[model samples]
Target: MSIFEYAPAPESRDIVDIKPSYGLFVNGEWTDGKGEAFKTINPATEETLAEVACATDADVDAAVAAARAAYDKVWGPMPGRERAKYLYRIARIIQERGRELAVLESLDNGKPIRESRDVDIPLVAAHFFYYAGWADKLGYAGLGPNPRPLGVAGQVIPWNFPLLMLAWKIAPALACGNTVVLKPAETTPLTALLFAEICRQADLPPGVVNILTGAGETGAALVNHPDVNKVAFTGSTEVGRRIAESVAGTRKKLTLELGGKAANIVFDDAAIDQAVEGVVNGIFFNQGHVCCAGSRLLLQESVAEDFLARLRRRMGTLRVGDPLDKNTDVGAINSAEQLERIRALSEIGEAEGGERYTAPCELPERGFWFAPTIFTGVSQSHRIAREEIFGPVLSVLTFRTPEEAVAKANNTPYGLSAGVWTEKGSRILWMADRLRAGVVWANTFNKFDPTSPFGGYKESGYGREGGRHGLEAYLDV
Candidate 1:
């Protein structure tokens, strides 16, 4: 039996039990927005999760005012040890309510429950724990002498990894004593709402970490708010470009963990079986809904055919179904629009004379879903090779030499991350140095660490998140 067949369906009302119709959390209170209310939907089921209040410009002003006020009067003046305690409490609460948070994450964001439970939630807690340790250790970091907090931070995160992204934004900002007003993606707001409650439970000061749920307008409002001292965003290259332009002359510190077209290089010396597994994890994890997904596969021409066969077989075994199922590997696409994007790109690949193949997997009727897809005979010039599809699709291209592999890998404008699968330590180090990406994984892909700084280069965006480096985003050095 498949994993979905044995796994029980999630109750529809579980999110309601946690929280419903979440509003703007400002000044230590949950208040309704001045604008219209927008309904958030479960990407897995196409069902309404809650009617989240949309934050208008006025709402952004209110949030910033509250945050600034708190920064001066409360959060900024609070001792680092006290900040650490609150972060520790929030981390512990997240660990205790992990299962609930996991289910909500999968239901709303269309990520597999296994990833939510084992990967996202755990990392979310660890991010807090790691930053908590750094709360009072700012002097130890090489940020000159006495780096001060940058007042209020405005953060906008993508729909891909809702709570984890929230944690990535909030943890460091709070650790550095910067009040924050964050805008969670409109599609997945439940986890952020739940996070707001966790902050409340941790007794985090009001206006310290406010969550506003809405679409583009709300995010723009937050970014343009005069009092916002720093702007951090995680999303598409297009949006990242706009943000780069928006914050061009401003003194606001900026960090963008944007989109990627990371190359997963499989060398002739690599363990074929292990390389296949690494490739599967690289692109297919989270339904390929990741900024740093290894969407491009650079196989050594010597082992290309064998590696392709092995990878195809491995993909055939992936059970793509309900994300809540423990046994499922790939889950539903985040939304119908995203599914359309994948389909359109696949069609273009076919039209461009590339061979498109999809794994034989049963899909749910209600939600937007796509099978694991791959395009062979893909050249560097093809749209599939160049663009960020942001779906369960891979573009296979072969390279003869290590130099050729590195050239192909860095061909794209994005430099968020890359993967190197090789047995030789020297070759791995050599490739890692050549790859322009900020994060390079040897025999692995998509690994995160709170102590590790993560970001991109060139068009992929600027600055870094995570580790002691993340504090720089919220500090006036």
Candidate 2:
């Protein structure tokens, strides 16, 4: 370690004033839920940030009713340009209050302030801005000339990128003239609540957007609600399956962005230094909490040893500590439960004969933290390679040929995302064509844009969530 000591550069927490308790946002008002309130804490310090009300079946019903009312009266009858104005206002406000939202997100979600500031918040605002322009041009979106709104879209987002996921689900729905009842993940609901305040600040019509804060039950209630015409979810594969089952035989249109075990494949012809960086970013970004994180690394046998050495050195430099620290590279795990799951899966990896290595960073004492970890000598059948650990863990497996790489990468049930690193353009295109994933990143990893259509091919879930395709989920042809 270098001798030069850097002073702590912490983001000011004073920027956000958290309420003692928060209520559900329904019909453009803050209302109490039928269920008991639960405390939301910072996973970095294990400090309780606020008591957020858990929505019950009754609350879900009320939200759906509010959304239905808004769809029938305010939102549905509103002209396209009028709807565009409201969404543009929202996008602008998010930018104006970007700092506060970023700080709050880092606090509640235990992701580094840098990530929340640089990645999540910017993308959240951009998604809205991107979709806002589409509000008045639905005819050109290619679904039909006179596409119509599906009343009352029910959206359930995951904790990994709470506000960003919210923007993905809500923006398109609103742009297409549909009202929404959204449920933010239980662990990270603050930014969504703050967004509710943004809606109020924009003077959005009453009942156009309803925000419910709760756990799996609340999500289920929203998904199963009779008045909800379209349901969108971003979370676990298990929960997605359950939601799919619950909505069966109903008229509700469904779109799910669920779990993934993506493989980042590196061929012998790849630029070794760039491939190393891509591997690091693939599994370590957002503490590996990303649903589409490239958890498995497939290296050609000729380059595996050299790549592993460089990757180990890279992982050692990652700093894991307070999320508010601007210099922190990796932050705490999102929850205690998630940390334990990571630990259990790592133990399974070792038991299955894979060699384990972790970063040298020291964790803070009070919160949920998991070091950047890698499992070498991993087989395709290893649990760590197959399962979505959803943490800062990577499993390394080698392939002798391009065909072997493709076969190993596609062996899993997930088809959410994958990465390819190579200098050969023809081989890159060939691999991309053969891969079963929805989003294939050539020469990069984990890059997201609002204009890109993203989702999966198989068990990763169905339907696209961005670009022109996103509008189709909320519109009737």
Candidate 3:
């Protein structure tokens, strides 16, 4: 007898029109870069998606100069209300072009189409709209009466949630009257390039938004550019440190959203079913590529075995396959490099004596893939519990009491985000206060809103993004 399956319900790849080779978006124009070109491929099938121009020193300089010119002559002189009109146009355009963007994002980033469609794209549009509303209201935002835009912002975004991360950095920067030169991760440069077209379609002023497609070197040049008055980055913590160091003596303002090993704690008093779902979503969503993914699961000792049993049952039902598959709950790991990292760390977890449990799912023949994984019998001292495994991997550690939970959770260097599950409001409040994380969710996990400020504390990096707080990053308060 055959079992039930979601079938091959793939979102049509033909919905997006990817060009043969893409150029850098500099000064509001598609221009060829001086550096060598590299091909970006589909991680699921290892098929060449497009050849992208890498930004050279000259390219970075040109983009920065363009942004500086726009800042000095066009963007800065514009009234806040007028600037808002442009932002509103861009936001509306994003909504109008949502389908094309979503398809392209799933292809390039290897996220499930549903996530790209429902979660990522909507949030992208929402961010632009949210910041657009703030464009003319900077004074009343409580950031002071005369907050001025920073000159030229050099933004570097990561591959995970490519368009969403771009939105997080770009929307607020533009709304604050700053011009920007953005460097997208080489593996996921397509969406950023397409967004450049959206900017042009919106009739945004020339040089106001420039996109450079390249790898780490490209990002380095943009970050180190003398003309860039502000630098904002989202990626690994080690890389964030280098960026911070590069801007240390310079007058350039800097903000970074880096790595995390967030702890998701479940109390015995919590609803087991709700906590299990939240825990699953926390580590398995986006193939667990989230910077703030709840990678560490801190379960109360009493319910540890019971919760694991339920969690294992739920994991069995996950559909992992092609990213374009509408029914796919787990997608391909973003890249071969990322896949290797996840593999190495999982091996380390096993070597450290943690029992590994992986969901039974067949991966595609070609492309980077990893089964949904969790390590049981994990201790706070184990590498799996302490380290940031930015993949669909979870490390389970049990705690006897609330204090013990907090103690084990806070043992890590990362302080990006955490989650708690309990029925008691007072206990929720109590756990939240002592978590030492920047964002703490009561019952849910991985919830994001454009109007809410999100950031990290300690080694997870400094400063916030989203809401009125985000405006401060791009402004001269």
Question: What's the ranking of the predictions by lDDT, best on top?
Answer: 2, 3, 1
Off by over 4 Å in 2: 1-5
lDDT tens digits, residue span 354-394, model 2? 99999987888899999999999999889998999999999
Model 3 CA deviation exceeding 4 Å by range = 1-3
Writing each residue's lDDT as its tens digit, candidate 1 over 283-329 gives 99999999899999999999999989888888878988888777788
Provide the lDDT at 56 for model 2. 97
TM-score of each: 0.97, 0.99, 0.99
| Per-residue accuracy of model 3 over 14-41 as CA lDDT, tens digit each | 7789999999998988899888999999
| Candidate 3 clashing pairs, residues 3+ apart or interchain | none
lDDT of 2 at 46: 92
> Considering TM-score, which of the candidate structures 1 and 2 is the better prediction for this target?
2
Clashes per model (N, Cα, C within 3 A): 1, 0, 0
Error of 2 at 367 (Å): 0.2
